[model samples]
Target chain A: MNRYGLKEKIELRINHATHHIEVDVRDTLLDALRDQLGLTGTKRGCDMGECGACTVLMDGKPINSCMLLAVDVMGRNIMTIEGLAQDELHPIQQAFVENGAVQCGFCTPGMILTAKAFLDHCSNPTDDDVRQAISGNLCRCTGYRKIVEAILDAASRLRRGKRHV
Target chain B: MKTFEYITPETIDEALELLGEGAQILAGGTDLLGEMKRGLATPKRLINLKGIQGLADIRSIPDGFLTIGSLATLSHLAEHPLVAQHYPLLIEALQRTASPQIRNIATVGGNLCQRPRCWYYRHSAFPCIRKHGEGCFAMGGQDRYHAIFGGHRCFIVHPSDLAPALMALDAEVRIAHADDSRIVPLTDFFVGPRDSLTQENILTRQEILTAIRIPVPPDNAYGTYLKVSERKATDFALASVAVSIAWLDTQVTHARVVLGGVAPVPWRVKQVEEMLIGDELSGKRIERACERAVDDATPLRHNRYKVALVKGLLRKALHAAHRSREKGEK
Candidate 1:
């Protein structure tokens, strides 16, 4: 049964299309991004906040949507794992797929989005920066060395493209 | 999580008016919501303070202070130009708190006003005194993260990196009551476990922290917050110190030594401050000050190592602050 006082289906633009879905303030953004929108790219490994499998960009910064309320994100530019690209994969996403960063595939989306946020702000981040950027996202499948490499690789590739243009 | 009545007021007075019965303020739901999720905190109403106007802006006052709205998230603290230039220790402390993801939504007021993160307090099974019960099991149970000072009855640390740094920076907290407003220094903001085992800070029920005001950094002042933790981020400091040191050339003009992970409040070392002042801030003098920092530490059975760890952290903080001072105002 729908919970009482669940506000009439709030209109949220996911990816490119707009959809009307009912949600309570208690329901998290991760719940709507996955359960309602059917965009399961954002994984839900640990419902508890420990694991960052459900990280997403809210207003262009990385946040654990599992810990954020969907109702609170009204008018904010909410970008998800699915919103990272449309016609093609995000360069970071492609790097993840190519560099074998996707082990169990549970943490790939959050990792790629987090990397995008980092590189978008810092074109050239040191090892400490890279470590700090993705400290929230955990991947038990493959050691973090590969994930770090892909992000650094993608960052350089993007910078080179900017120069050539 | 239990469903409660939700009210998002746009004005501070309106939000304060909605208080009387059973309502909890929700600001950047980093801590309050966590309590509700575990059924640890179940107010009859949930007051969303995010939509409240004028509570998220950051600006400076002509009186040599920077005012941070209660709703200003930790991310804002790290990125705001005034905070970055005037209070680097505050920024470093926020960086020491959770990761970038969590910091994006965690508010500084909530961080300072956060409830105890003790396993006993969070878990429902434990009848912890922190949860308004008879005794705190952490005294004999798993207490690796318990307190080292002011724990005559209960031994829980403050658990926020920003609090210690604010204390060192001589910040003041402003709160809005039902009819009036009052301000207090950062050190006086905390209430010890012995004082009120149920509350973390000294905010009244209807009162809400409207803003935190940090004074302008002292001339020749250099500040740094050093936290040692199990992980890079998203973990509380095992032993953290926010050290602010100022000097003309060799002799110390002022020094603020605030320690976290060692007590209920931001434990300041008076003797440590005494040992450093009027003396050259060389490595030798700094070492002597560091030893004096933990002279009064009386750790329990398990937390004995915290004394040495805190001392080491203080030395690192002094050197870091000294290094930052080398590049003075330009």
Candidate 2:
């Protein structure tokens, strides 16, 4: 209770591939992802849950990491934009650049992460599916048409891979 | 934000034991933490209910009750096949609340228990009746999206669309105390601002809302919920309705009509229910029922548009429900 404003012991594993950290329960997942763990890929745009700038996957589902408390995600497996690329760009990231989906690149990480989550669930998505997939992410410099193209193009590649195998 | 003590209890009893007058129980933190950061809601202690064991499950109980855990996210409710099949009104309401990202972290319990979205209430400078001060400034200030029914001390409409749909489905609450539990109807869950001007719910500070139970209606029931708002989505409803009609071969055997964004609570319509009883849902009957929706509405200066909007949406919703009754499972 006496150490660094911690009233209770909180054992957390954030961006777990990198490090194990201990934080207070009051700290949000966005804080742990940005400040403590230095996994700044998760942007902190709106501290409120209005924007999807802080989107992350907890146990394979997309959620607002800003609205989530660090202690709430204690034992849950977390995946961020950093976890998506392992010295190699993911298919969605590749498609984003190939289709000119990213502009200003501030909202790209969150949009790409949201797309990855959707593609993980659905391989063959229609235009409406692509629109619905990234409906939460807001691109101010606005590359929606390109984002939809990238997701549909990636869906084709993924489906072709499955058919070849 | 000022630093406060945090506790994550794994059981309802433990969470209740930690709650007190100024201690807030954290369901989803979608509302509480944002308020804390803005200096709008300053609770001394935050009791996190996430670590609790059974507060996240959604299952059907015996006696035709669909029990929804308090920790069940709005995203789950929006996509759950069972909820969509049984209560389409509820699904539509959940679909229209905020964005997909916000729904992922917002809890079903917290959605109903949320404070008003009034800019003044969040700003804390208006000295509104909600802040335990003088009268609301929205009365004389820019009051575009204020109240139209059953609002006196404060004129903020309820922000939750899911709350109205759930109320129309005859939902019940499971409030867990330290050593006991109690069940109350969803309509009776909220207290008016004129009643207390501070407290929004009837539950004590120590009671944790464990679960919600929605009674299962008959199999051949048709329901439609619609909200007419300003934006395409991600905005609160200017006016909303959840109408569930039990269709027996052709006629509406049973009807539950409830309105949202018209008052501080879900603002049920008893006159509409009485008007629709034992009558076939023709175009004229639907129009008659829609007219009765705003019979008791006392619209404020800027909110008079809501009455006509509410009438049109209810008429459209009734027609949609009637079409669904004839179409059978789209």
Candidate 3:
């Protein structure tokens, strides 16, 4: 039986960098990434899993970071928004820019990550599939039309092997 | 959130033994963590069950039932081939649930055991009867989302879309305790506020739900789940209905009608089921049966809309099931 108030040491591989961090047992992955590691690119919106701003890739699956405990995700590979751009923009990121899908940009990271996961599973998708894929990421600024178009454009680019990253 | 020790038990026996006093089981943490952030529950120890192996598998038992481990994610269940072909009602309800990200993380057991989303119960300021308070604030306050059936002292509704669907499918749950294990019908799982003001279900502190078993669908069985929520997604249902029927050509042989979002539990209307059985699912017959769906509903002041909403949902579900059965025959 574990005792309360014990700080646990957890290691996470974020953006290909492994870090050993100490956190309270109740600390969420969102808090560890934003507060401890200073990866503030993943925004925290609604924190209660209602909003998708805190989405990140865990083992290639997009999940809400705000709802996951850091200790629970020990030794897992997490890809945050900061990891998306190494030297150049990822294909999804470029599509968001060219299609003018980034307005205020709060929901952009989550939208892109969710689209990335969806596109990985479905190479050729329809308009309805794109809509269903990004239904979790809500954007009040772009009215979602541009975001949908950007994802479709990204899907075509990836299918054509135009952009690998 | 309050400070608590997180224990990831590797075995079910270890997890059950750890869940004694001042301990709560943590599956998805989609609901428990939020409740903790809101100062609702301050458990001293959190028994994280994610480390246990073989608890998340979905398998078909030979000559028995389809067993779904409690830890199976909602998204996985929604997309499983067997669920799509055999249990369309569950798929429909899961697709209409919270957004993709939440479904990816939220587990089936966690969804079934999650607490009510009543504003009074969630807010720390209200201190309603569900929170061991003196009275129910939603009785006279903002009660647009309260229950319309099986509510006496409290007026909160069950917030699970899968529960009503499971009830309609005649599912059962396997509960594990330290001493022994037992199987319970999904219909008898939930407890109302009139029965106990504190606990929502019959799960004791020592017990943990292990898996859910769904019997094979009968011949020519058709099922559908319809939900009417305030929003398209990520919102609790205003009212929902799950209809499952075994049709013999144009006549209904067996039927199960379970209602949600307007009752303390998944409300099973036996009268409606009886009315549907042995009768052809005609438009007038469905309309008349739906009219009686809310005959025992005692809607609160602000939720009288749910009475009409439930009827409409029932009618729509019945029609959808009929259409699905027709499409299957082709």
Say which candidate scores most in TM-score: 3
What is the CA-based DockQ of model 2? 0.46
The TM-score of candidate 2 is 0.94
Clashing pairs in 2: none
**DockQ: the better of candidates 1 and 3:** 3
Predicted candidate 2 versus true structure: per-residue lDDT over A95-128, tens digit per residue? 9889998778888888888888888889989999
Instruction: Give the DockQ (2 decimals) of all models.
Output: 0.43, 0.46, 0.63
| CA deviation > 4 Å runs, candidate 2 | A1-11, A14-18, A22-25, B328-330
Between candidates 2 and 3, the one scoring higher on lDDT is 3
Candidate 3 structure quality by residue, lDDT tens digits, A107-149: 9999999998999999889999998888788787855999999
What is the DockQ score, from 0 to 1, of model 3?
A: 0.63
Deviation in Å, model 3, residue B313 alpha carbon: 1.1
Q: Which structure among the candidates has the greatest DockQ?
A: 3
Task: Kindly indicate the candidate among 2 and 3 with the higher TM-score.
Answer: 3
lDDT of 1 by residue, B33-150 (tens): 6777788988777778888777998899898789999889999888999887778788888877887888888998988998877788889888888787888788777878888878
Q: Give the per-prediction TM-score of chain B.
A: 0.96, 0.96, 0.97
Considering the two chains of model 1, state its CAPRI-style docking category: acceptable
**Model 2, span B1-330: residue lDDT tens:** 777767777777777777887788778888887888888887777787777787988988778888999999999878888887787778878878887777887899898889888877888567777887788888878777888887887888888888888888889899988878999999899887777678677888767788999988766777778988887567788999888888677777888898888888788898898788787889999888887888888877787899998898898888888887778753
